[model samples]
Target: MPDNERRTDQRLERAILELLDRRAASATICPSDAARAAYEGDDDGWRALMEPARRAARRLAAAGEVEITQAGRPIESAEARGPIRIRRTR
Candidate 1:
């Protein structure tokens, strides 16, 4: 990947982690509401924020930092849906 793309990816990862931390502290996040408030506060686009959030979630799952499961089966689709929760593995 290009240097700029790598930097953007890192930034997204960091942003996602920060958001997750905030959610953990608050116990929940209404995605639509939070995204709107963030955009109003910083002029960031919701799609920009969401793309990275999804990427970061996938990376976390691959690293075992978070587990992605759907119903009783492991998720096979990148677009799979269900409840996604984070847990500390260490």
Candidate 2:
């Protein structure tokens, strides 16, 4: 990947981490509103921002920085529904 792409991926990962941190601290998030607010942009713009974040989050979950549970998948702060809440692992 190019430098810019790497940076963008890093940014997405950071954003996802921040959202997970918020959930860890807050317990729950209103997924629909949170997603809209976090990815405030038109369809294409939102997709551009969120697709990267989603990919990054998956990687992080695999790496164990974030925990993923089937019962309650970490909420993708970019989607209104369907996300299980994600939490930071000890």
Candidate 3:
């Protein structure tokens, strides 16, 4: 991957984790939260980071750092179809 893309990916991952760190251990966060945090601009450009944020969440899930859930139930990242939330693995 290009350096910029790699950096973005890393930033998204860190954003997801950092955001979680600020919440209660049992609390969860939406991917959009990380996307918005990762985005530096003061515009709707964060929308473009949505997919990247989801991908970052999936990567974090694979690394056993987080869980991806839909309807409050843990699901495989690949099986996450619609809206989902990220939470620290319990």
What is the lDDT of every predicted structure here?
A: 0.50, 0.55, 0.97
What is the C-alpha lDDT profile of model 1 across 1-90, one tens digit per residue? Answer: 899666655665555455556655424332333234334245656655554455555776677655444443446337566554333232
lDDT for each residue of candidate 3 in 14-65, tens digit (9 for 90 to 100): 9999999999999999999999999999999999999999999999999999
Ranking by TM-score: 3, 2, 1
Write model 2 residue lDDT over 11-77, tens digit each, in one string: 6666666666665453532223234445546664555555455566567767878654435555434
TM-score for all predictions? 0.50, 0.56, 0.99
Model 3 poorest 10 in a row by lDDT: 73-82
lDDT of 3 at 42: 100
Ranking by lDDT: 3, 2, 1
* TM-score pick, better of 1 and 3: 3
Clashes of each: 0, 7, 0
CA lDDT, candidate 3, residue 10: 98
Displacement of residue 87 (Cα, Å) in model 3 is 0.2
Off by over 4 Å in 3: none
Give the higher-lDDT candidate: 1 or 2.
2
Runs of candidate 2 exceeding 4 Å displacement = 25-44, 69-85
